[model samples]
Target: MSNSGWTSIAETNIGTVRKVNEDDFLDLPEAQLWCVADGMGGHAKGDVASQLITKTLSDLASNAPEELSVDSICDCIKQTNYTLIELSNQHNSIVGSTVVALFFTAEHAHLIWAGDSRIYRLRSNTLERVTRDHSQVEDMIDAGLISPEEAETHPKANVITRAVGAAVELDLDVKTLPLEDGDQFLLCSDGLNKVMNDLELEHALKTMDTKTISNRLIEIALNRKARDNVTVIVVRNEKQIEEALHETLPLDDTLPLHYSNKS
Candidate 1:
């Protein structure tokens, strides 16, 4: 997707080991929204939860895109959470998913996330995570119980502390930040980050364009034998590039800088 202010793209894979792609993503640049969801539970239930989110948001985009806002999006997600919980109860099984989404408008970006699915930003040639994981190891990290490197290989690394349907009440994390001219964002499932570290992610984003960044990241994940489904969305704010071009443009000699009034 390309517009005057943003250029964005998304990609996903079942991964080398997973039989089913338990991950799904929503990309509607027309509404200036994009999301990555990682479903959990058995195939049917997991698919149900994630796809439900995708469809719900898709319908909202189609029906009232002009009305989309952070609060409105959150309201829709909360409704989906309630529906997922009811479905899980009726089926006597667990059905849940992690969600990470980005919404941009008016040179500002709003982020919403839960569980380990993440959003990161690359600004001023530096990459940093925008959303923290809602997972067991993250709790441990906060308590000073485990190093991130240790947590990566820990037995409970995959154990998430929160998801849409994990509990009756869903508390989403939200952040709003002003967008810079060269700002870029990466939203993805745990699959991609599980195999690559932050340094690797930064390196890729620093060097790759929006068109190929997602594919390159997925390829890196596959090379490392990603165990879970992977999904990646890369968005670049082209406003900075446009400004740079305008600033550096050579002035035409035909344009006069001084008047003959002095004579």
Candidate 2:
């Protein structure tokens, strides 16, 4: 409820099944960046992997907020990937995480992700998924082997093909969009989306502000007995905050800063 620059709130829960909440997030509004990372299931020290991803970008953002941009964040994630691989080798187990980050610059919102974690943008009562999931089911859908609805309940729904520490080399996707008035963004792990569909999410984003949308999203997921670790981060482009920060660029002028399918 504070009138500030790009307000954000994050929530995480262990859910009804998992004993450990192997999910972590970064909510640094002052740096105009927020992220959600879900630890790889069936992997050891998953919580450690998720924490490391957030901590790595957090350190860079804290030390140099002005330098926080798409390139810098991607570099930090790649660096974290190497760190997690080393940690996994030392533990003799696979330790990895799925990361989705939202970085806000003066005129655009930059997004980067790997695995099934996602970022969604709601503008003018319409919802648009910003990042395509890097998962087995998603691939099936791409190949016309499965319908979107079937993919939801597919046995392999939880099987993600890409993650930070799973391979010697890391692959990440980057996208950018112009900032718009009343544009609200949702960053979450698969737990939230698995239980609630796009219609429910659109309803929440259309009617509520950032904080309310965040609480309500988690409340609904927990009510549905979210079986996996649940985490959500809701952010909005507040006009007052934008003016305070001097990012008064007209909407028409804001365009995708850069594009990369994978890196």
Candidate 3:
């Protein structure tokens, strides 16, 4: 559960069909923060929105206190939403993103998200989705009008009910989970989930390291001709209270961040 014992890695890809990658991610092992943003607008503008989100999160990771708090992270996201709203207004177009962020304290983790990007946890060989999609199909399923199987391929599945910058006021869902050794979390855009079911994801995460798991997930999505940008972040808490904090390492923005992206 300790911060020092945790490690994270993230990657994003344009997928096989998209001309431009509109997805972005954040991986801050030092701050124990990770995020995935799926931009929704037209090609380049979508990329702009997602990049802005990840960049804001990167700055937060740099300036964050030694101990991260839910309040601070929530405030940052609200500010980012404001910025994105202004940007959208300036362009006179819908520039928005779906965000799923994970922040950790020593013994617990907090999740915040909007739109359909998801947070999933793998523990004891089981994979469970922690975030629900804020989409029309999900609403139908909730109202008992549609079965889970029917909702997946429903025509309105991609129609998200909430998003940053889509409206002036944004709503975010938050949850907290107690931490344990070997607890692994996966945060991803809808692109990945569209192609891989819970059973497939659980099998992929069963024995691989974080890097391998991430690669395998993306590979599966691409093999399925994933229609949207794919992005993933994996966090593993290896042990509890293992050591004292070391010097704060200087992160290089010009160089590759802890996360990687593909066009």
Candidate 4:
């Protein structure tokens, strides 16, 4: 890989217990936008809610300007969240999705997320988390009421405090960092965190290719009998030499790769 371009791959699985995968993803390298949405509306409409989000993002990517910006991405997400809230109200059911998105430009890399899905970065062979979970256990950990280790297995671990449709209004968590060559970003659902510890994830990220890293993470999670859907997207930024052309990625049944603007 050179040092002037980005290469990405995405994958999602239903895991060992789930009969239907409610997770969805967007992989639009041309737009420099990638997203993962984990649905939590039971079997009948979980996929619908997740797919709806991806559809909105796809439209936004298709109409995006030649050069992308963080504000545009954030605005689109807010509109999508509002739409989701309306849909949930009409159905008289709690339909929500956890979203984690990565927006990249030549000058910056920005992460925006809600709920428990996460964004992580691998730089200089060290892995660091870029986003925090909006969950009850995370609140307890932050308030010094519980240790991180204790919170992991805490009964309230699954109780998320925020999500796209959890409320009519959503406050997104956003972080911006200077763009650097050789930097890799990983976006995943909680299923991956539930099984692969930081050390295991770091080893694979440091040793594998972008696509292989995504697959290896899912494999590791399933072998542990993950009870939730596992989804992962790996994006690597490097200088472009001969491979300036974009690459297409593969996805599972539950994970459809949506790209309105292909490079």
Q: Candidate 3, TM-score vs. the true structure?
A: 0.87
Please give the TM-score that candidate 1 achieves against the real structure.
0.88
What RMSD, rounded to one decimal, does every model reach?
A: 12.4, 9.1, 8.5, 8.2
Tens-digit per-residue lDDT, 1-263, candidate 4: 22246878999999988888999999888788899999983623677777777888888778766635677777777887888778778888767888889987667888988999998888777889889999999999999999988987789888888777768788888998886656778899998988766765666666565546688779867866888899999887644212432333332212222311111
Candidate 3's C-alpha runs over 4 A off are 41-44, 239-263
Q: How many residue pairs clash in each candidate?
A: 0, 0, 0, 7
Worst 10 residues of 1 by lDDT: 254-263
- Candidate 1 structure lDDT: 0.81
Kindly report which residue pairs in candidate 2 clash with one another: none
- lDDT (CA) for every model shown? 0.81, 0.83, 0.78, 0.77
Q: Kindly indicate the candidate among 1 and 3 with the higher lDDT.
A: 1
- All candidates in order of TM-score, best leading: 1, 2, 3, 4
- What global local distance difference test value does model 2 have? 0.83
lDDT of 1 by residue, 1-263 (tens): 23366778899999988778879999877688999899994524787788888889888888998888999889888899999999988988878898888998786889998899999998877889989999999999999999987898789898988888778899999999987767778999999888777776776666665566687778867766788899999887655544432221222221123311111
Residue 115 lDDT (model 3): 90
